[model samples]
Target: QYLCAIRPKDGRLVLSTMVYADEVNASDDIAELKAVSETELPDKELKMARQLVDSLAGDFDAERYTDTHRQKIMALIERKADGDTGLVEAPEAEAAGEVVDLMAALEASVAAAKDARKRHPTGVDEGEGEGEATTPEKAVRKKKSA
Candidate 1:
């Protein structure tokens, strides 16, 4: 078999890959990319990016997060075998909100994040303990204190 992951010599593998997104305007060279820093980014964009990351940041609950479609399909198969169609109808999904512009998407994300926080104040599902929540601000503060 070909070794795509680990190298026996160093016990590590390096990766070089491009992102799947064609919309993102990325520079050809790493040097070109490194030339730009957060300071150079517009205040609005930087702030939104920070907010987006902060809001989305959380410990993923393996028990909760899963491939719902696959689960549904399996359940559907079971139901079909048992001569029943137990709630496996394909549900309507929103159209892929393809990014026409990055800034607009960022703004929408910020708004959505705020709304999500409002809905789940503890950043987890209802009745869950606060131990699951981890904000970037809190983590940074903790590190500084330590």
Candidate 2:
């Protein structure tokens, strides 16, 4: 396995590559790579950014997430195989008026996110309990309510 970090330099991106060996060797390799890169490049900002990144490094966990879109696609395939038509009209896209103030939009987004967190403390919807499948209508209603 290999870990790579990309940072913006000038007008492009520069990648710092490091190979992963054993646990001990991986840390040594990363440190050596960083040292070599830092010595070759005399950019204080990049050096500081690299140091900050190294300080925040942690183990990679792959099992903590699920691909909902892939799951939904497979479910739809199964339904079609079972003689279901599986036809649904796509929702109309809402027109977003011109965004004049980026700061206000960002602030509104943060406020909305905080409100949502308070509404759903567990980060799960009311009817989204384990093994309790949510239908399209239920999903639409939930979004409308929100």
Candidate 3:
């Protein structure tokens, strides 16, 4: 529903993302992924996965997120226009193929999301009105003035 272009095909609605498929590259990235049917997965694993997703139901709304990346870019442009000489340093490169603890990460995320929900039950962030969902101070840090 979020996609701009959608068309009806054989009584089913499908997203028309491109006008032409000439530039499309249907390579290994697409071919490598295979959907595992419910029958293929063990019942216990399927049930646990479903339960985990159910627990995170309230935390995964698309509307709750703001485009922080775009906002940062816009802010940088404004800073440049205002004659601010600060150099926008490139972010440090991360280690290639770092293994992560998925379960621990998920648990931490759940805890943080639940805490945020408790703080704001309506899902509307506190500082969203001024074109940001987070505090301006947190978004751009400056040196303390004596």
Candidate 4:
């Protein structure tokens, strides 16, 4: 809403903003407001107003947040001291010849399914394989299927 002071001689109305939608019954110094209404407000006055609001409503608490990574590192160091052997697997390097050929074929098949939406005009979706089995027995079965 606007507070309008209309001049009777002319049709023009002098408009002044009263309050914002979010600010419910916000307090202001009437004397300073009246003074500024006639003149211009200074940057020092604006900064002081912001400082007053922050002093009344803002809470400064540092202990509310905790460092999770530091805690995890400390726990891992303790486990290392106790001689705990974690199940860490070494990454396999790229294979050569026939192995590379088979890997390329599998990758191409997967790519075809993933990019089906882009290739097909009618937008027919295709599903992906849920990877090769984990156990040795299942791995053997998977190799037999290939």
Best by TM-score: 2
Worst 10 residues of 4 by lDDT: 5-14
lDDT of 2 at 32: 40
- Best-to-worst ranking by TM-score: 2, 3, 4, 1
lDDT by residue (1-146, candidate 3, tens digit) is: 12233333332233343422333333323423223221366679757766764564332233444556667999999999999998889999987997899999999998898678646534546445633334233335588999
- Candidate 2 is scored at a TM of 0.32
- For model 4, residues 1-146, the per-residue Cα lDDT tens digits are 33322211121122233323332222242333444345556779757755655565433233444456567778878888899889545659778655467888999998888687445444443443354222322323335553
lDDT of each: 0.50, 0.57, 0.54, 0.48
Tens-digit lDDT track of model 2 for 1-146: 34576544333334544432322232334444555434554589767877776676555443444556667889888888999985856879999988688899899998898568546534544456664533343333335563
Q: Which stretches of candidate 4 lie over 4 Å from their true place?
A: 1-57, 88-146
Per residue, candidate 1 scores C-alpha lDDT tens digits across 18-88 of 22233223344445434333236667975776676566544432344455556678977888999995664
Q: Against the hidden true structure, what lDDT does model 2 obtain?
A: 0.57
Clashing pairs in 4: none
TM-score of 3: 0.28
Name model 2 segments beyond 4 Å from true.
1-50, 99-146
RMSD of each: 23.2, 23.8, 25.0, 24.9
Q: Between prediction 1 and prediction 4, which has the larger TM-score?
A: 4
Clashes of each: 0, 0, 0, 0
- TM-scores of the candidates are 0.23, 0.32, 0.28, 0.24
lDDT of 3 at 20: 29
